[model samples]
Target chain A: MMRAFFRVAWIVVKKDLTIEVRSLEILSTTIFFAVTVVLMFSFGLVVDGRPLNDVAAAILWVAIAFSGTLALGRTFERERHNDTLRALLLAPADRPALYVGKLAGILLLLALVELVLVPLVGLLFAAPIFVHGFHLVALLAGGTIGFTAVGTLFAAMLVRARSRDVLLPIMLYPMTVPVMIAGVRGTAALFQPTPDLAVAQFWIGLLGFFDVVFVTLALWTFDPVMTD
Target chain B: MHSDFETLAVIDVARHYGRRKALSHVNFTCAAGDIIGLLGPNGAGKSTLLNILATLLAASRGRVEYGGRTAEQAGADIRGRIGMLGHDLFLYPELTARENLVFFAQLYGLSGAHARVQAALDRAGLGDRADDFMSGFSRGMRQRVALERALLHAPRLLLLDEPFTGLDQASTKALVDRLRECQQAGCIVVLATHDLDIVDGVLSRAVFLQNGRQVGEPGPGTALRERYRQAMTT
Candidate 1:
């Protein structure tokens, strides 16, 4: 069963990746949106001449969170369109495998977007992002996993609803606030000259706990939702 | 085990949709090589019955036993032994024909996914199209791909809901031929189709359903048409 789960997970992830590669809509759109958010924030903050550290984390998290939500919504909407969601449901594999596969795919995309946005945000805001490279990267990794876990599950649910396109962001933003909060705070603390491992560890620990709880719940709920 | 080899026994299966009854006190049995055609006007619970057997939906009451094990006790294990083709094609249009089959074989935990995929395509008469992208294929080709997917795992039981839809004459002939191959392999094939073309040769027995009740198990000759006529009038 474990083997089947991972095998199915890999297949689903490949399918999603292939779709993105073919269309290029998700990759290009998310990058453009994230960059725009960064640029808009930079413009607003430039006139005041405030230090970059004050709002750098907030700008990064908000931009990444909304862009991530858009990408997640598109992933599921694509599945529901051709009844590929039903195809996955019909596969003779464990349901958690589906969840893990989708979660991994979303995280992969999120990681790619963040990879570019991180450096750009630093250059635009004149902040010391590279100085806290390892710690900040770890914080982003932890928060992205947690965010995608909930986002993928909710994306599956919203795809079947009547107002799926509109309802997704409204539903996603509230659930994602905690991860964003922990992520922004951790990143902000890491930018300090004396980086606080304690703050970073706290948020990472919280992110881990969130992953465990939601992943378990998502597994249990997926069977019922996928069937219907 | 051989004593119950050909039996699909159901013990008082019932289903409910909230406060409404979808299926009520249904009981039936089918033997190996028997292709029973389910018939009803609409909302006669045909889908509900097929859904339970396909393991896609659950019954609110009673149990289903196939080859002597309760379906609930052997859900995952039973799924391995059953092939299902529903209204959904369940294929990735972006992927090649071979890729889709390989993926499903992996899901079924088959180690030699490559050989199984080849065998399935060969049987479906799609070996030449194996490398072709699926999006360009016609509906008949898609249906054939779905049929091959159902048989890739070598399921002991095949459950098809409205399998005859969207097939041209040649493809339909190919489908009937493949179904015969399945029966020859000793797999119990259950077809939920409205097409009465197979009333004589394919199925040994047919169950006539009307308003969630089994009126009778008609024999191979002249029974399906007679039963369908009897069902509609009454």
Candidate 2:
């Protein structure tokens, strides 16, 4: 059973990846949106000779959060377009496995977007994010897992809903508050002149906890919520 | 498990969508080699019933049993053995015909899935266009690929809702031929379609539904159009 679960999940991941690779729809749009957010913030807030370093972490997190939401909506919107979600549901694979598979795909795309966004934000805003690359990656991983875990669940739920475009963020943002907070604070701690490892670790741990809780909840509720 | 393994029973199945009764007290049984033609007008619960049977939607009141095991009991094993084709083509427009089949076959966990996918594409008469993206294919070609996808796993119980929606004349004849082959292989087939003329010769029995209720006892050889007209009016 475990082998089957992993195999099905891998197949789903491959399918999504192949589609995204061919179309470049989700990755391009998400990265563009994230870059725009970073540029808008940099232009709006950067004062005379004073970097927006204090709020750089907050800006990065907001960019990721909003762009991640966009990726989540698009990932599932593709499924809705051809009624492929229903096809996946009708397949014999485990429902939670499907959720995990989609989560992995979304996480991969968001990671790519972040990879580009982080450097752009650093170069544009003069924040030295590259100095704490390891810590930043950890924070990004933790927060993104939690964000996409819940985002994948809600996206699947609202795939067929009429108001899914507006409803996805409305339903997702509240649930992801912990993720955003942990991500922002962790990034902030890493950016400090004398970085507080303890503070960053604490927030990272909280993000990990959020991932565990929401991923488990999503696995349990996916079958019921996705079915009629 | 061979042909004898095919059996599907819907016992007192009722589905309600927030007090709107889509299906109420819907009951039917299908055995091996049974091609049951499900006839109903719009909003008569044909798709809803097929969805329930496909395990995509749970019944509000009753249960669907396959080969003496309810879906809840048989779980993924039973689901693995059932194939369904709904209104949607269920193919990714960006993927080629062969790629789509390979993806689904892998998901179904079929061993030698690549070979199976190729065979299915050939069987669907899409072997020549296997490399072309579905986005470029005509609606008839897409429907053919969808049929191949449904038959990929060689499911024991095949449920098709409006399987002939977008097919051209030749494609429609080809689909009817494939469905006949499925029936001959002893798969329990439930086809929900309004085109009684197309399916009349292929159906072993005809089941008429009206307003979520089974209206009449129509035998396999009964004239379906006459019976359907009578059921709809009276």
Candidate 3:
């Protein structure tokens, strides 16, 4: 059973990657959107010679949140249009395995987007992102896992709903408040002058706790929510 | 362990959508090698029945059984032995035919996936076109690929909803021939289709449905189109 679960998760990730690599639909669009959001923020948030205090972290997290929402919706939208989710659901694999696999794929896609967006944010806002690099990475990982874990569940749940485009953010943003708050607060700590590593670590730890709880809830709920 | 089921039994199965009943008290039994045809009109619940059998949608009442065990009792692994091709073909358009089949084959954990995928590709009859993305294929070609995709796992119960839709004559003939091949392999093939004439000679048994209820007793014989016409009219 464990073998089947991992096998299914790995194959789903492979399938997602192959399709994404060929089309460049999700990765390219997501990165473009993230960068655009950051640029938009740079316009509003930057002052005489620098971004306002603590605004850099807020802008970065906001860009990640908004663009990550788009990425999650678009990812499942591909499956929805083709009704391929039905095929996946009809597979012999476990439902939670499918959820975990999709979450992994979305995380990878967002990680790539952030690779560009984070540096761009640092360059524009002068946020010193690489100063507390390892803590920042840990924080981002914890926050993203929490965010996409819930996002994956909701995106999949809404795949069959009419007006899913309208519903995704409405359903997503609320359920992911903990993720968003932790991500922003942790990154704020990291971005502050003379970074508060302890505070950032605390928020990162809180994000990790949320990740565990959110993933467990998602895996537990995925099978029933996906079923008609 | 999942493939050993010889019979798929629908026992008093019914599915409802709010107040609308899509299928009601439907019953049938299909043993391995039997080609069961579900013939019906536009709103007659043919797809609903097929979906129920595929276990994609649960019946609101009663149950579906593979061999002697119900779907819930048999567990999800029972789905490993069930394959379906429906109105939605479930193929990723960006992927090549080989890629799609290989994906499904690997998901099924089929040993020798390369050979299996090649065989499926040949069955799809794409030949030189197999390497191209399916987004470029015509509807008939896509249908063929989807059929092969569904069959790649060598499922014990092959459920098809409107399997003949959008096929040219040659492709339709090819599809019927493949159904025979599945029957020969001792697989239970259930077809829900409006092409009663096309499936007339191939069906091991025919069940006519109207407004979610069976109209007549199912039997295997000639002149199925005429029989279906009378069943629906009456």
Query: Each candidate: RMSD to true structure?
Result: 3.2, 1.7, 1.7
Candidate 2 residue pairs in backbone clash: none
Model 1 spans > 4 angstroms off: A1-5, A40-54, A157-159, A166-171, A191-197, A224-228, B1-6, B197-201, B208-223
Clashes of 2: 0
Question: TM-scores, in order shown?
Answer: 0.87, 0.97, 0.96
* Residue B134, model 2: Cα distance from true site in angstroms: 1.1
Positional deviation of residue A41's Cα in model 1 after best superposition, in angstroms:
4.3
- Candidate 2 chain B — worst ten consecutive residues by lDDT sum? B1-10
* Clashing residue pairs for model 3: none
lDDT string for model 2 (A41-158, tens) is 8888888745656688899899999999999999999999889998899888898999989999999999999899988877776767877778888999999999999999999999
Candidate 3 docks with a DockQ of 0.76
Q: List the global CA lDDT of all models.
A: 0.78, 0.88, 0.88
Q: Provide DockQ values for all models, in the order shown.
A: 0.47, 0.84, 0.76
- How do these models rank on TM-score, best leading? 2, 3, 1
Best by TM-score: 2
Q: Over the stretch A1-228, how does candidate 1's per-residue lDDT look in tens digits?
A: 577678789977987898778778788889899999999989987655554555887888988888988889888877776566765665667877988898888898889999889998778766678776777888898788877888898899877688987887787778878888889888878766677878877887887787778778888898787654
Error in Å for residue A158 of model 3: 1.8
- Candidate 2: docking tier: high
Q: Lowest summed lDDT over 10 consecutive residues: which window, candidate 3 chain B?
A: B217-226
